[model samples]
Target: MNAAVLALLLCLASAATYATAAVAQERLARREATAEGGNRSLLRTGAWWASAGLNAAAALLHAAALRYGPLTLVQPLGALTLVAAVPMGARAAGRRVASGEWRGTLLTLAGLGLLLLPASGPAPEETLSFSQVLVVAAASALAIGVLASRRAARSGLRHAAASGLASAVASALTQTVAVSAGRGGELLSARVIGVALLVLTFAMGGLLLSQTAYQGGLGAPLAVVNIVNPLAAAAIGIALLGERLQGGPAGVALAAAGALAAARGVLLLTRTAAQGAAPLPQARARDRSDLVGVKPAPAPESATVS
Candidate 1:
């Protein structure tokens, strides 16, 4: 098979693995308070641990994709995790997704697809100082991730912010790797240094953040962290590195539209949590008692939405 085909397959596999992990991690997070002595629930159930494993698999698969595809192509495709996570949540729990959930999912995927399509290249690749760029990016990422971690020491939101920041840096670096590998026409060269730095700085940071985020809330943090990562990378690719699409202004405009649609979808999904939107089958009349994936128990059923 060709590199592009290989890259596509890797991207899909990574999405599936990451989605599965997200589902499992959410279950563990819901049980956090109830985990007596603050012991790990997933230690026996292996939910969090399994999620970590799946996340690792995803990072590796993503690396393989960069080896063969353009960061421009591979970076946008990371959005597939969003597509993967929701349906997987539905299927694993033997639950029916509500119309709102379905609508949110579709809108997200539609907008992301538009924003993330691979632009066939017609322009010469640009090059810059390898070590200096990598060093700067790495130093910046470390500072941000560390500061976020420290500031968010006791807050779930802080941890989420830290994790999300790291994840985004990792994703951008992953794409940078693919670009670097391609530039040198060899995996190890001066051109490849940027890619290596991207991995060292961002991907490494992502791993640490993933652990913390998965410990908190699965759906919200996963969605936030994973989504932010690629958006950051794609933005940097276009703006900082002068990456261009072959189809000119129309392509750029369409890409912008797609991003807006996807962002709208994300905002709607976020409101589900923020505005006290009912989650899953509890809101649905036919929900079963034996829901497979776990989440925090509902506030009193009698509790009124503000």
Candidate 2:
């Protein structure tokens, strides 16, 4: 097969794998949330570890896709994870996919496609200095701290956004290291080693944060992560890597519109998820009352007579 076809297949496979892993992680999260004492020990759970393994496999598939295809093509296809996830999640929960979720997923994908399709080709070969890497790391940490603060109402969305930022920074750093190594720079130098360590730290941080994010629900949080990941990475490319969007002002306008659309989609998704979740306590309470054989008191005789 041609490179493009191979890349497309690989990307699709990667999306499916990611969706499956997300379902597994969300299941684990839900169990932890409802469990007594809330052990929250994901590391000890075989399913969590299995999900992590799936994520690693998906990453390998995605890497192979990138090797065969350009970023503009591969990156957008990555959004298909949300598409695959919605139905998969619903099926796993023993429910039909909600219309709102379908709408939200499509809107998110459309917006993302608009946002990414206008991108110019590969970025210039670039490397961040050690100091620059430190600066980037600090900024990412600050952003994550702000989003992941306890005051956040939507814990899943907040954590997903933070995870996206961390993953983006990690991607930027990985690109830097790769570019430097490709150009025959010192791969074993102290600076390189430091950046490599930062990459690992951010990557793992993103993973753990995502695991937490899945506790709320699958569709919205996953969409947020996928949306934020590419946008943040693009921002880094523009600000630090000398990258620019094509078509100048027109391109900028298009990107802005796309951003707005993507935001709307995320809002719709979160609202729907929130609405769905709002009655859980009452439902569980009713279930508990039934279990205990509780019954409502009858009306007074006067009231019944009236």
Candidate 3:
């Protein structure tokens, strides 16, 4: 098969790998929550390490895929990891996912599929020249990530938002590195032994932040983050590197469809969350009455989203 075809397959495999890792992460969170009042450690429980491992595997797969595919396909496909994690989390918690979640997941995948359809041709193998673009992109991505991570504790969804932004910035830098690096360079960096280290460090930081965000708000935030990351990277590609998208309006239309699908998925997740939020005030009011022993309440009901 051609390079584009190989890239497309790699992209899909990367998505699947990411999704599996996310399922593991969601399960770990549910387990952590269950052990909340008990003695536990992230290390002993193997949660952090497992997450790191799966994520590393995914990153390796993604980087290889990137060598074969376009950024637009690879990054968007990775977002599915978040979408897949929600139901997995619910399952781990022994709760059934709401119908809305199922709908949302389907919508997200459908949209992503639109964006991943192979670009026709053997794929560009342009020889690249080392430039300052990668370094500048790195600095900018790090700055933005630090800014966004400050919001993680506010709400679960905020976590997703932060992760998405961080991932986008990191991807932007990564793309710059991949596209700008000279194929002719004998060394990883032109001058230093640690240049690859910086690249690896930024990439890992992005992954860790994104993982945290996914744990807090697995769906909506990731959806938004996933969508926004590529858009930003693509924008960078267009403006800085003179990258041109193949196919005129048709390709764009397909991508728009994917964006819309992902958007619908976000709407479903947020609406379910909103619906769940509605009962909280009423519950609080009842709790106040119960404090005075006024209302003889039934035992605390085990409520789960269905």
RMSD of each predicted structure: 6.6, 7.6, 7.7
Superior by TM-score: candidate 2 or candidate 3: 2
Better of 2 and 3 by lDDT: 2
Give the lowest summed-lDDT range of ten residues in model 1: 283-292
Instruction: Give the top-scoring candidate (lDDT).
Output: 2
Q: Rank the candidates by lDDT, best first.
A: 2, 1, 3
Instruction: List ranges where model 1 is wrong by over 4 Å.
Output: 36-46, 90-95, 122-129, 135-143, 146-165, 175-201, 208-217, 239-242, 274-306
Q: What is the C-alpha lDDT of each candidate?
A: 0.60, 0.76, 0.57
Q: Return the TM-score for each candidate structure.
A: 0.70, 0.81, 0.70
lDDT of 3 by residue, 1-306 (tens): 766667667766766676666666544443444344322344455556777787777766666666655565556666666556666655544456778777877787777777655223333343223355455446556655555555536655555554555555555444444544535463456532333454566566555555555544355655666666666655554555455556778888887777788788878877765564232433434434533447645545674434
If both were scored by TM-score, which would come out higher, candidate 1 or candidate 3? 3
Candidate 1 residues 84-149, lDDT tens each?
776676555445444555566677677767766645332224433565456647665665656565
Top-TM-score structure, candidate number: 2
- Top-down TM-score ranking: 2, 3, 1
lDDT (10s digit) by residue, model 2, range 38-123 = 43565766777899899878866765665555444556677888988888877666466778888888889889878876775643
